[model samples]
Target: MEQGLALGMGLDVGRREEEEAASADEEDGEVRRSVEPAVPLKLLPLLPVPRQPSPPLLRFPSSTATRNLDASTRGIDTNRAPSTEEAEEASSSSPNRAVSSFRTGFSAQRGSAERGGVAERASSILSDEEENGLAKKKLRLSKEQSAFLEESFKEHKTLNPRQKLALAKQLNLRPRQVEVWFQNRRARTKLKQTEVDCEYLKRCCRTLTEENRCLQKEVAELRALKSTHPFYMHLPATTLSMCPSCERVASTPATAAADHRPSSFAALFSKPTPAAPRQPPDNFRPQPPAATGHSCT
Candidate 1:
C-alpha cells in the first residue's frame, strides 16, 4: 500500500508541473502577439519616402491671343484689357511660389555671371510684349469695376495685406493696381475736402468784404455830415452862459444877435442907467395934517 501511494503522489505532482509550464507558454505567446504591431512602426523610419504631387503649372498669356486682340483694335489707342478669367487662372496657380522661384533663380545668376549681364538678364525673363513682339497692352477697367472699387472706398479708407489680396482677387486686378487705386481714391477725397474748405473761406471773405464796405460807407457819411454842418461838432466843455437880467441862455453869437440877448460877460461890463425922481400922488390930502402940526407947535 505505501509503495502504491508514493507512485500515485509523484504522478499528480508531475501533472501539476506540466500544467504550469503550458500556462507560462501561453502567456509568453500573448505578450509576443501584443509586441508585434510595435515592431513595424519602429521600422517605418527606415522605409523609403513616397513621391510628392507635382506642382501646378503657371499660366501665361498666349502670343496668338494677344496678337489677335491687338489687331482687332488697332490705331485707336483704346485700352485693350486682358480677360479677367485668364488673369484669375494665372494668378490662382501658386503665383507667390513662382515669384519666389524666379527670385531665387535671379539671385543665383547675380552671384556668378559674366559681363553684359544686362542683355543676358533681359533675355531670361520674357515679358508679355517681348514674347509676342507686340506693343505693351494697357488694361482699362470696365465701368462696373470702377463703380465697385468706388463703393469699397466709401466703406473704408485703407486696406491691410489680406484685404488688398482679397480685393485684387475679386476685381481680377493686380495687387499693386489695387494699392494704387486706394491711394488715388484717398487723394481725390483730400482734394475734394480742400476744395470745399476753399469755397467756404471764399464765401466768408466775401461776406466780410461786404460788411467792411457797408461800415466804410457809414463812416464816410458821418464824416461828410460833420464837415458840412459846424453845429454838429462836439460841444465845448464849459457850462452854458446866461444873462444876469434875462431868463434865456445864448448858445452862439448868431442866436444872441438875432434875439438881442446880452451875454453874461457883456452884462457884467455894461453901465447902469440913472433913475428919475419920485412924484406925489394925484389924489393927495395931506395939507390939513401938516397945518395942524405946525400951528400946534
Candidate 2:
C-alpha cells in the first residue's frame, strides 16, 4: 500500500510539473474566456386579467316575481329539498337577468397581488373532489350548457362574485367546478411557458457546446502546426553554440551585453592561456621528410 501511494504521488508530481511547464511556455497574449450564466428553462408568462367590462344592469322580478322569490335570490332555503325542475328554472333565467349584485372588498385590476393571495387560499380550502378524484365526480356540462357558461365568463359585467355564483347555480354546477376550470386553465398556461423556457435552454447549451468543440479543435490544429514549423524547430548550430553577448549558450544575451560584462565572462576564467612552446627530446626527434617539400604527381 505504501509503495502504491508513493507511486501515485510521483505520478501526480510528474503530471503537475508537465502541466506547469506547458502553461509557462504558452504565449501571454492569450486572454481567459468568460462563461455566461446558464439560462433557466421555460418560465410562465404572466398574463394580466382581461379588462373589466362595464357593470351589467341588475335584473330583478320588478314586483311580480317578488311574491315567488326575492330579487336577490337570497330566499334560497337549503333545508327545503332542492327539486330538479326548480333548479332548472333557476338556471334558465337570462344569465343577464339582474340578481342583486354584491361589490367586493377589493378591486380586481388594482389589487391583483391581493387577488393572487385570495386565489391561493381558496385552493387550500378545496373539497375532497378536487384533491384526487376529479374523475369520479365529473361535472361534464352539455355542449349548450358549456357554451353558455363560457359566454357568461367572458362578460365583464358578470365577472363579479355574486354574478358568478348565480350563473353557477343556474347551470346546476357546484361553485367549485367553475373555480377549478379557471384554475386549471391558468396552470396549463404556466406549464406551457415552462416548457418553452426549457427548450430555449437546451438549444443554448447545444450551441455553446458546439462552439467550445470548434475552439478546442482549432487550438489542437495550431499546436500541431507550431510543433512541425522550422522557425522554432531548426535553429542554426552556430546560434545554438553561444549567446550573442557573452558567447554562452544560456540566459539573456541582450541584457548581458547592455551591462557591458560580456567579454570578461566565465569563458575567459575557465580557458588556459597559450604562453610558450617546448622543444622535443632528441630521442623523439621527427624523421626527415622522404622528399623535400615536393609533391609526387
Candidate 3:
C-alpha cells in the first residue's frame, strides 16, 4: 500500500507540471495578439495561513482583478485595472481564435437587449392608447345647442341618417347624441298625451255612473207602485154613459180636455149617478099614420 501511494504521488506531481507548462505556452501565444505585453501571473492562493488543516486547492477572488477580466471578456465597460493573477487566467483560457468567439457572444447579448427595449416601448404606447379609448368623456351642451335641437324636434320627430349627420356637423356633436335627444323628446310627448286621455276617460266613467244610479232609482219606484196597487191593472172597461147631446159637446173639444174626462175606474171609485137625458128641439114634426088604425081619431 505504501508503494502504491508513492507511485500515485509521483504521477500526480508529473501531471500537474505538464498542465502548468501547457497553460504557460497558451498564455505566451495569446499575449502576442495584443500590442501590450501580458502581465506575469502567480498561482499562489490569496489567503493567510489557517491554524487548522484546510481542503486542498481552494480558490477565491483577489479583489477587483477578477472583476476587470470578466468585464473585458464579456464586453462590459469598467474603470478598474486588471491584476497580474486575473491577466494570466485570461491569457490561459483565451487563445488567438477565442477572441472572435468572445466578441460574437457579446454582440449577440447586446442585440437581444436592444430588441427587448424596443418591444417594451411599443407595448407601453399601445396600452396608453387602449386606456384612453376605454375611458368615456362627459359632454355638456351649450344653451344654443339645446335651443337648436328643440326647434328641430318640433319640425320633425324623427330624422334620417343624412339629416342626423348634417345636424351633428352643424352642432359640433356626435350623431348618436342627437338621436338620443330626439328619442327622449318623443317619449315625453307621448307621456303627456297618455295623461290627458286618462283624465278624459275618468270623467266619462263618472258621468255614466251618475246616470245609472238615477235610472235604478226610477225602476225601484215603479216596482213599488205596482206592488202597492195590484187591482189597478184589472179594472173593468166601461164607458162614461152620458146623454147624446152632452157626448157630442164633449167630443167637439180638444184632445187634452177629452183626456181629462173621468175614466170608468175613476167613476167606480167616486160612485157618480148617471147623467139626465137631454130634451129635443122645438121645431120637430110628427108623421101621419100610414093605415086607418082608429079612423083618424
TM-score of every candidate relative to the true structure? 0.34, 0.28, 0.33
Write down the RMSD of all candidates, one decimal each.
42.2, 35.6, 45.3
- Ranked by TM-score from best down, the candidates are 1, 3, 2
lDDT of 3 by residue, 77-150 (tens): 22222222222222222333122232444444444434434334322111222212232223346667778889
Q: Which pairs, if any, clash in model 2?
A: 41-197, 41-198, 42-194, 42-197, 42-198, 58-98, 59-98, 91-170, 243-248
Q: Give one digit per residue, the lDDT tens place, for model 1 in 173-197.
A: 6654576689889999999999988
Give the winner by TM-score: 1 or 2.
Answer: 1
Clashes of each: 0, 9, 0
Q: CA lDDT of each candidate?
A: 0.39, 0.35, 0.39
Model 3 bad stretches (over 4 Å): 1-140, 229-297
Candidate 1 regions off by >4 Å?
Answer: 1-136, 229-297
Output the worst ten-in-a-row residue range by lDDT, candidate 1: 35-44
Better of 1 and 2 by lDDT: 1
Q: Flag regions of model 2 displaced more than 4 Å.
A: 1-136, 144-163, 166-172, 230-297
Model 2 agreement with the true structure over 1-297: per-residue lDDT tens digits: 332222222222223222233333223222122111111112211111112222222222344234223212543331232232222222223243122121232132234323334324333222333322231223345665567666764543123333434555666564445555555655676799999888777765664555446446545644564476535323333122332322224322232222332222323223333332332323222322211121111
**In model 3, which range of ten residues has the least summed lDDT?**
288-297
